[model samples]
Target chain A: SQTIHQWPATLVQPVGSPLSLECTVEGTSNPNLYWYRQAAGRGLQLLFYSVGIGQISSEVPQNLSASRPQDRQFILSSKKLLLSDSGFYLCAWSVWEHFGDTEAFFGQGTRLTVV
Target chain B: SQQGEEDPQALSIQEGENATMNCSYKTSINNLQWYRQNSGRGLVHLILIRSNEREKHSGRLRVTLDTSKKSSSLLITASRAADTASYFCATEGNAGGTSYGKLTFGQGTILTVHP
Candidate 1:
């Protein structure tokens, strides 16, 4: 059984503050990791995804960035948060496979309130 | 731009009634997946249907895919109040671009099942 852990579960930070959200997966190695953000009552936006360590792909230009420091450890960071950056951030993982039949598993998201 | 779009942005139904949601996508896909999200929580992967498959079932959930129509539908039978949540559809394109295995999500359908 694989499990993903994300923290802090909720955060309240002032504008322009630095931010760091970590996600780690256990019981799996070399899995694909992704970072996503969802606005209030809106669809999810892909932030970043990594197929392997030290590799990251950005889907859209935004104030946030992601990194894969270890095989199962992914981190989302922001040097300076914007009001628009406030949203629910999520981390997900899937087994790296050919192309199909891969299902992603998500962690309990981090709700960031930038005031 | 979103690759997938879910219809009926919001749905309200009584418990035990069946809930159906449709999703449409623009490009060729390797597979399409349905996910469920409780309020303020991360998504849970519910079902995945490959492009070659027309229908799939898991317990009370049934998924149908139409490659010709470029659309998919998720059916929840005998829905319960616990099924009240947002449902999203994600697509993994078959096109061997750099975005392979990177799922593009649709604006979800908010399902409200009354007890």
Candidate 2:
């Protein structure tokens, strides 16, 4: 069975403060990892995705960045957070296959509120 | 820019009723998937229908896809109060490009089932 773990289910940070959210998955190898953010009443926006270690592709240019330093470990970070950076962050993984039709598994989200 | 859109931004229903949500996308997709998310939580993959398949079912979930219309629908039969959540539709591209493995999501339909 595969499980994804995301830390600090809730966070409150001041504007301009550094931010880091960690996500890791177990029981899967070489899976495609993704980071997404959801607004209060809107759909999700893809932030970053990694096909493998050291390989990252960003979909939106925003205040946040993502890094996959090791397989199954993804980190979302921001050097200086802005008030608009607050949202629900999610981590997801899918099989690294070529068909592009596989389903994704998501982790518990992190709720960040910038105050 | 490839994001999909779900209609009836919010839906309220009673327990033991049926709920239906619709989603439309802009580009060609390899598959369309339905996901459920409780408030401020990670999304759970509910069901998926491929571009070649017209319909799919899992438990209480029924998904229908129309590639000609580039649209999909999710139906929850005999809904329970616990089924209240935001339902989102995501599409994966069949045409590979820089954004090959990423899943594009639509603004979700918020479903609330009351007991």
Candidate 3:
């Protein structure tokens, strides 16, 4: 059984503070990873996705960036956070190709509040 | 730019009634997927329909896709209070490669199932 983990579960930071959110997957190897953000009562916005280690594609232009340092480790970072960055962040992973039973699985998520 | 847009920004319904959500996309896609998100929680994958397919069912959920109309619909039969959540549609385009994992999301529909 594959499981995804993200942390810290919640964070409160002042404007311009640096931010780092981590996501790791267990029970799978070399899976595609994705980062998404959701505002209250809104739909998800795909921020970034990775096909392989060190390979990332960004969807939106923002102060945030993502990196996949290892096969199952992904990181979301912001050198300087802004008020608009406050939202619920999610991490997801999916198996490559072989779509038989492969579906994206999400982590518990991180609630970031930028004050 | 988002790929799909769900209609009826918000809906409130009594339990036991059926709930239907519609999604329209801007460009041609190879497949479409639906997801559900509880309040402040990560999204959960619901269903996926290929462009060649018209309808699919899982439990009390039924999904229909019409490539000719560039739209899709999700139906939750006999809804319950626990069905209250936001629903989003995602699109997988036909570019870059057949199995490319890039997915674009849309604004979601918020469904409130009152008990």
Candidate 4:
């Protein structure tokens, strides 16, 4: 079975501080990885997605960026954190199917609070 | 911009009662998927229904899709307290290209099943 692991379940960061959140999937190769953020009591916003290594697509313009360093390793980074950046960040992975990508599986998520 | 919108931002129901959530989306889709999220946790994929299919069933969950209306509904039967969570609907566009696999999520409906 495939499992996704995300680090730093919760983080408190100062404004303008650098941030790094890592997500890795074991037991799957060449999976599609995504980064989503959910504001308090709001819908999820897709920040970035990668179909392969070194390939990332940004859904909306923002301070955050995403990278897929390996086949199953994805990282979300920011050079400087903003107060608006504080939210629940979720990392998910899905496998490609004949029709499209299959249902996505998510990690526990990283709750970052920028103070 | 968000593509899907779920009705009844919050619902409260007694245990064993049926809970139904509706979602509406814009644009053509390849498939629609439902996900559940416990408080402060990542989402769990519950079910997926292709655009070609009108309805699908899995255990106590039933999903119905209406392409003409560009809407979908998720029905949870005999709900338990454990079923108290936020439910989200995500859509994968039918556009056959790099974007076909990307999922656009809706604002979720929070379901609270009281014991």
Which candidate number would show the highest TM-score if scored against the true structure?
4
Residue B31, candidate 4: C-alpha displacement in angstroms = 0.3
Q: Is candidate 3 or candidate 4 better by DockQ?
A: 4
Tell me the spans in candidate 2 whose CA falls farther than 4 Å from its real position: A98-100, B97-100
Clashes of 3: 0
lDDT rank order:
4, 1, 2, 3
Q: Put down candidate 2 lDDT per residue, A1-115, tens digits, no spaces.
A: 9999998899999999999999999999998999988888888888899999999888888898899999999999999999999999999998846464688999999999999
Stretches of candidate 1 exceeding 4 Å from the true structure: B97-100
Residue pairs that clash (backbone atoms under 3 angstroms), model 1: none
Encode model 1's per-residue lDDT on B1-115: one tens digit a residue.
5878899999999999999999999999889999999999999999999888999999999999999999999999999999999999999877775454678899999999999
TM-score of chain A for the candidates in order shown: 0.96, 0.95, 0.95, 0.96
Residue-level error in angstroms, candidate 4, position A42: 1.1
Q: Model 3: residues >4 Å from true position, as ranges?
A: A99-102
lDDT of 1 by residue, A1-115 (tens): 8999999999999999999999999999899999989889887888899999999999899888889989999999999999999999999998856557888899989999999
Regions more than 4 Å wrong, model 4: none
Ranking by TM-score: 4, 1, 2, 3
TM-score of 4: 0.97
lDDT of each: 0.92, 0.90, 0.87, 0.93
